[model samples]
Target: MSLTLAARTQHMTSSAIREILKLTERPGVLSLAGGLPSPDSFPLDALAQASERVWRTQGAQAMQYANSEGLMPLRDWIARRVSLPHWQVEPEQVLVTTGSQQGLDLLGKVLLDPGSEVLVEQPTYLGALQAFSAYEPAYRPWLADAQGPDPQALQPRNAMNESVRAAYLVPSFQNPTGHAIDADRRAAIAAALRAHRVTLIEDNPYGELWYDAPPPAPIAASAPHQTVYLGSLSKVLAPGLRIGYVVTPPDEAPGALALRARLLQAKQASDLHTPGFNQRLVLQLLADGFDLDAHVVSVRQRYKAQRDAMAQALTRHLPEGCIWQIPQGGMFFWVQGPDGFDAAASLPDAVEQGVAYVPGSAFYVDATLASRQQMRLSFVTLSVAQIHDAVVRLAEHLRREGRRSC
Candidate 1:
């Protein structure tokens, strides 16, 4: 017998980053591919205490099914934590998701139709591309300047007559680029979106992971009625909890409400709700004064040292013409190899030297063979000493490749 599948599945592909990660799982490779937080940074002991407290107090309530909107107190806490002095958010507008990733999938379900135009950065987040691809939207590459993505890219120009449904951006400490837009450019982008009446999905999981300084206010605060803001506990706390929240528009536009209803329906259809035990455990931690700010401060210090080590190692080992800019915050560094040097083609040689890194082409929605000269190296997972050795191995491989080119 033959089986049939939905047409939408045709465009879907396994995550390239994840596929590469599997290759790096060898015993001796020092992988700088995954954007994972250091295990040393997790508050495991505090979480254990919180779990014990939650089981004692909530007991059976923690095991039962929950409202699709998520735990009320958690929503309220998220609102309070993310809001600014000028920008206020109501708890009613918050929708807790399994993770910010699921939030992206739901947005794709409700906001996109086949052939809908969506604008994205030239080298955008791969996961977002994968999540939205199933909806079959036509993607327009947003132009970028030295600062970041250009706001003018969203305007209705005669060259591109298509109407954009939404533009997705990771403004702070972006995934592969590690570039943050300044406050002025953010305001410009908000104005452009408001002018075009286009919706903006601002994904900001790394905003709180800054090292030297705090990132600018969310663009959602600038244009509350036109933006959907996504936040997560993954970077600052732990990703295993899978707790993330979405702040919907204040006006609760028809589209916003409809989307929320559908998202809740989708959540119920998928998992019935995020694990209630984890929700209660998180709440208990917040209620018991877990000192999240203090925890973040400690994590920031550790990451700063790691970032410094990576910067120093890069200067010591990388071949001529290789370039990278040290990020003020965030986990990864975007590195450009010498002209015509393809990181993908050279991966075997790098691995033979006991080092591993992700080729940058994987991050683009419509990547090409010509884009293989760039790569992304994550500095958060490895210790300072290990990072030094990894860079040395990578440098040795690059030197060998450079001689072949010569």
Candidate 2:
């Protein structure tokens, strides 16, 4: 007889990106698949020096179990860094998380009631959808246009069975699409959330990787009382450190205070705390005078070159009917092929031909509405030459499928 399983266990599924990364490891394959930061950009020297300092001066303390709310100094630093001139975020408002991913899990646990509505972009971050699915919230797509998801449409309507609990978005350098919400849209979205009284989960892991000017201030700045802001060190520093923070609204609001307390309880249940050593190591890194801004400048330079190469390669190699909007910043190129070209179904052929990308369908809440012709390709993991060659190979394969002219 088969062993019994919890009903909630059925909700979990493997990450498609992780499954695809395994295929990418086969010999001779060039993958534009994983949304990973370039290893070449990691500040190894700074990390090592910081680790050594953590061991040398605060050895015992670093190994000791930390608080569920995270290290005070680390939280303080994050609060100050994210605070804008108009919006002041105090250390009491910050909670250090295992990663921004954990912050998503914690938010879902504390905020969502099964069947509650959660508004999302047309093609949102797949990880977020995965994280929130365990809580079983109903997703309603925020209608999007040339500018971005319209704020007015995101407001509550007579159609929903239940009240909208929250709206989640990657407003800066959005995952999959790589589209940053402009300042005007940010204000409009913030206003709408306030008007409708729906909470906002502002996930922004890629905001700092901007190739040109910084994206606008977070939507949280506009509707401070209504947003749960998330930020991560993974893209800017190193993913192995696995450090991120969640900023709840100011403490003066009792609702925000209660939400923060419940979230800490959820976090304590989840991991006790983010590893003590990791927290100290990051603090030590800051104390050692690591210039994060300068480091990010170097990272942006490398990624910009890669982004440029992929844009050029796609323009030169892909068929006439294929289309893509050159991303202004961030890691991916969201490409759309002609009608009748199914990106998800073409995966086996793409893999066999030695090139790989993530089909866009995995990002949508209603998989039926996902564009069959669309795909997301990440450029940071491959060299310029590799990107050029891989696009040529993919274009050749598309030619065989009747997508290319010659």
Candidate 3:
């Protein structure tokens, strides 16, 4: 007998990045494909101490089931940590999620309907597309330039008469592309969203990972009532813990109360709640006076050095006509190989040469329209020496492809 699946299953697809990741696991392959933070940055000893304290003091409470809204103290901490001077986030509006990915899924469940129009960057976060796709929304690619996604696209214009349910953005050190929206553009985006009364989903997993200076205040600061902000500790802390949060708009905002209630119901239906043990563990660490600010500073220094190494290697080894900009922060370097290069088709050869990178097409909503020459290379996980070696292998692969085309 054959089992029938839901219609939505047709839209569900495995992440191309993950599929490529499996290929890179072969021995001796130096992968530049994953957005993995360096293990050295994790405060192992501090976490160990915190774990012991939690087990000794509140093991039973930690093991027991938690409320759907998450631990109150942890929620309070998140609210305070993310709250800006202009935009104040309250604990009551916070929903702790398994990860920011779940926040995306939950938002998709509560906000999107089949055929709903959702604005997205031309090449946005692939995981988000994966999550939103399950809801079967019609994606409208937002116009963008070198500064990042254009704000004017948020306005309703020719051929776009339907109301946009929501617009998703990664304004700070976005995935696949290391572009960050500058201050002026962010303010303009906020204004456009407010003027058009469009809801904004701002996912900021890498805002705290800056090297030179912090990014501008989130667009939410200016339009707090119109934005649902998602944050994650995966990049700055350990991803294994899977701690992330969703900050809903203020209760006073339009439909904010109903939105919050529906999101909580979605969370309850998704998983009774995120693990209580992980929430307590994070609280325990904070209670122990772990200086997160100082820890973040240290991480920035290490990653900046790695970024520099990757920049130098690319400049020295890449074939003529290859293009990339040294990212100010974040893990990946978005690279475009010379004309006639097909990054997707060249992956097997690159992996064979002992290096691997994610093809840029994977990040675009319409892969058919994506640039064949672009690829994303992550620099955070590897050492300076390993970075150089990976670049050498990738450059060799590109040069070989170029010669073959000639």
Candidate 4:
């Protein structure tokens, strides 16, 4: 007899970016694919000191199994860091997860019912779509103009007969797109969510990594009762720690509590708890006067230089009609090619020429959008010199393919 798997498992596919990253491992290939922070920016000495302190001071506690709700001090720190005047979150309202990705999975399990309608950006975060898809939500595309996503798209419409149970937004330096919703749009989205009584999941892993001015206040600040704010230490501190927190609404409606409870249950099932040692280590670091703001300033300088390099490379190399926005923050640059060129179709050629990028279609909800001529390039991983050479090679490849004229 043949082995069988769940029906839901059948539709899932491997991440295209992961596959391309593998190809990029070939010696001499310049990869603009992975969303990786510079290794040089990590506070290795500080982390080592924190880890040592954790073992020496809290050794027993670090090794023991802890509560599913997470370490109290860590939760307290997160609550303090993320709180706003409009949304004063308490430690109890925070649920710690292995990473923000786990938060996404737990939210999907708790809130999404099969076939329920959820609104998402036209090209949303692929990882989010993957996390939510396991629960089988019917994704309704949220429309966007140059300014960013319009909140009206989530409104309950007589024409579509759809009521959005929830809408997910990155709001600040969104993945793949690297575009943030402006302040006005943030308020509009919050108002719409409140008016329609829809839940909002605000995932903000990259908010603190801004190179220029900070993005707008979170949508949660505007509609605290209706938003679930997810924050992470991955980009700012270290991803290996896998520490993230969720700030549920202040009202703590039955739905919100139920979702939190279910998510905690899911956490218990997944890992019994986020590792105790890591939590204590982070807490120790915070207590030790590790200035996150100053550290991030250094990080911002490195990334800003990279962003500038990528922008200049694109301007000098890319063919006419190709366009991209120079993001003020975040790690990605979303590029759109000429109308008839598909990034995926051109990937083999790009790789052969010693450069790699993620096809934009990987980030889209609809498979038809895969054919659209777009790509997401990461400015964080490659050196400035390599980015310039890669862009020249990529432009040459595109011209050879007749997709563009040099």
By TM-score, the best candidate is: 3
Tell me, by lDDT, which candidate is best: 3
Candidate 3 collision pairs = none
**lDDT tens string, model 1, 1-406?**
8999999999787887887788788899999888788888999999999999988888899989888899998999998999899889888889899988988988898889999889998788888999999999998888789877888888776666656889999999999888999999999998988887789999998898898888899899998878999989988999999998888887555477776677788778777777788889898998888999999999999999999999999998898989999998889999988876889889878887788888888877666522777999999999899999999988888888888777
In lDDT terms, how accurate is model 4?
0.86
Reference-based TM-score of each model: 0.97, 0.96, 0.98, 0.95
Cα lDDT for residue 112, candidate 4? 89
Show where candidate 3 strays beyond 4 Å: 158-161
Model 4 regions more than 4 Å off: 158-162, 252-254, 369-371, 403-406
TM-score computed on alpha carbons, candidate 3: 0.98
Assess each prediction's global lDDT (C-alpha) against the native.
Answer: 0.87, 0.89, 0.92, 0.86
Question: Ten residues in a row with the worst lDDT in model 2?
Answer: 397-406
lDDT of 4 by residue, 1-406 (tens): 9999999885566778778989999988888888877777889999999999989989998999999999888888888888877767899889999999899988888888989888988788888888898889999888888788887887788876567888899999999888989998898888988888889999998888788899989998888888999988889888899998888876455477776777788888888999999898888998999998889888899999989998999999987768888998999999988767778888987888888889899888877755467899898877888889888887776676563532
Which segments of candidate 2 are over 4 A away from where they belong? 159-162, 403-406
* Lowest lDDT 10-residue stretch of candidate 3: 154-163
Query: RMSD for each model, in Å, please?
Result: 1.7, 1.9, 1.2, 2.0
By lDDT, the better pick of 1 and 4 is 1
Candidate that beats the other on lDDT, 2 or 4, i.e. the better one: 2
